[model samples]
Target: MTIVVAVDESSHASRVVEEANALANAFDDSLHVVYVLSRSDFVDMEETNVSETGDAMDLDRVREIAASVAEDAITDANATAESVGLVGDASSEVTRYADDIGARYIVVGGRKRSPVGKAVFGSVTQSILLNSRQPVVAIRKD
Candidate 1:
């Protein structure tokens, strides 16, 4: 089974990749990295495009941009893992992918958020931690 790392554009993504890489090496497992572009990202992108270009982006352009961003994040992770850039809900997609692949472990990055902040913002990390059936390793931002 693979060691799956759920990646994003967050600053702690590299740390998560490093930790997942180490785990994969230690466990003699393949490393699988994935970046999910949620619907919210599409909405944000459309808003930005409208504001900047005076028009909203088409679906194809939005998907292209999302894939590009995912590729950039995967490259920045700096690991030689097999990577996938997908479009879906972040936490659910990551967890579902890991389950579907029968991952040995799932790695994710965590930001230090106050209880109130977490309650209001609703963290993806927290969602994954709570929902995933597989072993999850959370790497906190330094």
Candidate 2:
């Protein structure tokens, strides 16, 4: 089976990838680490600060982190992993990819709970959990 892990350019991304890597190794599954370029996040920022925005558009840093983690965490030599770059809503893109690949699990990093309810997750995490047909595994950020 496949394990899909979605990440952003945050410290938590490395941790999330590592966790997913371990899961993949355990099950002898392939891993696909994804970094979604949130249109909502950068479009406005792109307008306000075009210079800074150009650099952020490069997702190599995020991809490299996941690649390194996957390399370090591999227990099964045959297990494979690759990084994917996407553009769209994080939740939708991730869940869609998981469904498309028939992933065993969609792994993510929990940002926090919504202000509305303690049990309610932040928008992205909540959306993935609610919409994904595959099971989800969210690593809580420290």
RMSD in Å for all candidates:
3.1, 5.6
Clashing pairs in 1: none
Candidate 2 Cα outliers beyond 4 Å, as residue runs: 41-80, 117-122
- The clash tally of candidate 2 reads 0
Q: Write candidate 2's Cα lDDT for 62-119 as tens digits.
A: 4454345444433222334776766678899889989988999999888666678645
Pairs with backbone N, CA or C atoms under 3 Å apart (clashes), candidate 2? none
Q: Write the per-residue lDDT of candidate 1 for residues 1-142, one digit (tens) a residue.
A: 7988888877777778888988998988988778888888778888988999999788766656655654565567676787666677889988998999999899998889999999999998899999999989999888
Candidate 2 lDDT trough over 10 residues, lowest sum: 70-79
C-alpha TM-scores of all predictions: 0.80, 0.70
Best by TM-score: 1
Q: Candidate 1, residue 35: CA error in Å?
A: 0.8
